[model samples]
Target: MAEDSSWMTAGAGECAPSAELHPEIAHPARIYNALIGGKDNFAADRLVAEQLSAAVPETVAGAKANRAFLGRAVRAAAALGVRQFLDIGTGIPTAGNTHEVAQAVDPSARVAYVDNDPIVLAHARALMSGSGHGATSVTRADLRDPEALLAAPGVRDLLDFTEPVALMLVAILHFISDDEDPYGIVKQLVGALPVGSLLVLSHGSGDLVTPEQAERAERSYDPAAAGIHLRTRDDVARFFDGLTLLDPGLVIAPHWRPDTPPDAAADRLGIYTGLARL
Candidate 1:
């Protein structure tokens, strides 16, 4: 899809200062956007995406699979009667966003999108503005600081803690390194949700690649704000501890309750995805 310049025009004033965006450095979200054939990215982000795609031919396909998993997971949550959603590490607005999918299931469903990236926040705010979706709100917050993220006025105001919520961490955790205590971060956030809440998560895996290929993929993010940390199936499964994993638990992205038969290219994708109930 072409880059929608309309978001920039609508949210020009809301965008962060040039210094904050750091267009010279590649960000995971922006690179992912580029990999998915999006135009809202800088030269640096595109370069990284190109390098990764060259090394791993399945890079772009993997990104699309991850996005597809997110859509299916959200629809499943909505079908299960989840009316509230807290989506942290939300990347730049794209099609089939959390609010779009959830609200499509039930117009009254509320969605709170949290991301530390100013560009993402600006675009999200602009999209929500144009959609006239009063139940949705966007907040600028980091996943590393769950306390502040959960307490942000935008998040607190729009979501009721007493009710069930769909906590979406899709395609975001891989950006967090081991020192950052990714597991602890997830546990803290999941702890805050009421019983019956769901956790929708997807993370990149190195299991399908050779050591050399994995190294090359990691190097592609050298210029970015954060380095990639691909995990094993066991490591990724730990994130869902204490929750009830749904059918086809903790499988590769394309295999998780696939809406349609996955093609040959789908097997080469390296993302692991699953949904669990609290």
Candidate 2:
């Protein structure tokens, strides 16, 4: 596959449900792109992502680390012989997408990516098309609207709800506020799946950073994007209430069965990651 992507269509933007969605706002996905040094972001998103990066200079690394964890987690899910995947808050596409990783482990893997961003929907759909790609789809919808996401036409077409599916929520929880009932949202989403399903999730953390730094980062992301509610370790762990946490439990990112040995890569393991089986 020729990997360099152009916009799924030049008219994709104008053709979206509405043309009023301001491209000027600093959305989470675009901010993330800025942190990763990608060109898919707007100037506003770069400003905030940079501000947060200044507070925790590792914000860039933090974002990249979360992405790395997503890949490792997806591969782990496929290794369990679980071939269906439901990836929510699917950020702007880059290296190692859930379908790509899952399909790499099992060519027959099926995936459905959900996101509220039109840009993400457009790009992901482009890559997921054509044959020999397993079965993959993209849904433009909110995480809070789990029902809508689950009901999306493409989701129905690709994933069988009756089977064990890996539910991926990497680096997206923090963007969802408690007021939005993120916990309830997760519970309902997981509740919809059958037994042996998995919830492979990750969240940004404020544990190692000073309170002031965390607050500054939060303030930096406020004007646009979901306001950051960088949770404590226990808080992050709360998202996995009903499921059994896999070995190593909920821990720092670099600590989760890291590709690198324990002592050598200890310093960068600040992001919290976990793979739970339901």
Candidate 3:
């Protein structure tokens, strides 16, 4: 993979917001980190996270489950011979990262991790040190503009559009409301890839949660801020309309090719995940 300045030098003058100062008051990324019991979050993040957790303990389980699904989906696609991966909305890096999963399956695998959160970028870059020197990189970009994320030098420098690639949209599309055209955004990304490319995704769904529970979770976030727009299973499945789903089609997080079913299948955790090939 070729080195690019988009992450270090080029992004300095670019228009993008970061989580450097830790806007704990209403920071979703930090709150999510707190829910996962990570130390990188602030007091405000913890407060919101605790409240949200009290509203739904299944959230914590679902977060970890979604991450596990990401690893499983990545490894599965790698087994299919896809070497390059473009991970969009990669939240604050947890234990198993994109490059780690892909590279574990194949040493030469190249991955580009993109996210708008400054904290995610900071931690992800630090984690990549000494390991994926050239194979893995972190860039600042929003999911709303898949084109910008795809065009980011860190992405283009390593990934070749002519080859099959995996477009990872794990646990982030729920933040994007219907008005933002989340479906259109995904379609644009898939349209850019080659024939054998894959679309890896996980979305928040009201399918598993009761009406009151789903409403409570949605209201937990500040309406002005990014809200979790929980969709029905059918609506969630529509995001992958043109593509062919992998073995476990649009199932709940744990149901989609789980290593071991965690004995909590009936209690829906408001998340649905699936992988599809183009």
Candidate 4:
């Protein structure tokens, strides 16, 4: 992708909040970007990725697997006739973005990409500006505040609460610590959706790693803006409470209706994913 010098500027007549590029601090999204072989991150982010990868050699593969799960889940939702998407904690723009995949299935599909990271907002805006799909918006919001996130102008404008929507929380809920009430946050978001809406989520886990590896991975993310809180499979399942999980419920990322056959060790890769209906 070519660098867009105007990415920092909101399009004519648009008023989106701007964020500072704090390159010195490690951000979870940027760290994820680096892990996925993206170029939109900084040295601090790369350091976290390097340290985490060193501790758990499968870190990169796990990240890629999580991303793949997002694509498959989105495609499945689109194919199911859900036309609106509310993708929270959207990381930096990359291949097979929510809108790209959904719109490919149905050009009329609409997506609202929400994230607190300024870099992600900038890139999303740039992506939206050039999008021929026409029904996309980027909102700067934090998942910790579900009410505010649900009411953000971009989200409310692009998505209809009365209609079925696919709420995507892929590879992001792990960043929310228990103190932040991650479950409550998800509940609020889901409750706001209609009965037919779907929740697509993926979370990191420590279940497959030894205590030492988990500790080392935690230490690597100590300086990040949000610390990684790998949850048990049961803990992750709590996020789907009051909702019915779709086919292939709560499996490892690669095993969640995989497009291709998964390797034997795919279950040990540490990311649990599921798609559910309200």
Best by lDDT: 4
lDDT of every model, 2 decimals = 0.84, 0.78, 0.79, 0.85
lDDT by residue (tens digit), candidate 3, 84-132: 8999888788878888888888988878778777777777766655534
| Count of clashing residue pairs in every prediction | 0, 0, 1, 0
Full candidate order by TM-score, most accurate first = 4, 1, 3, 2
lDDT of model 2 at position 99:
77
Candidate 4 residue-wise lDDT at 3: 18
Query: In terms of lDDT, which candidate is stronger, 1 or 3?
Result: 1
Candidate 1 Cα misplacement greater than 4 A, ranges: 1-19
TM-scores, one per candidate: 0.92, 0.89, 0.90, 0.93
Best by TM-score: 4
Per-residue error for 197 in candidate 4, Å, reads 0.4
Which residue ranges in model 3 land beyond 4 Å of their true spot? 1-5, 8-19, 132-134
* Clash-forming residue pairs, model 3: 19-118
Clashing pairs in 4: none
For 1-278, candidate 2 gives per-residue lDDT tens digits of 11111121112221233224456788898888888788888888899987987888878877777887888888888988899998888888888888789888888788877777767766665564545666666666778777777776656666788899999998888988878898998999999999999999898878888889888988997634468778889998999997999978998777777787656444544579999999
- Alpha-carbon error at 199 in model 2, in Å? 0.5
How far residue 32's Cα lies from its native spot in candidate 3, in Å, is 2.0
Residue 101 lDDT in model 2?
91
Error of 2 at 240 (Å): 1.1
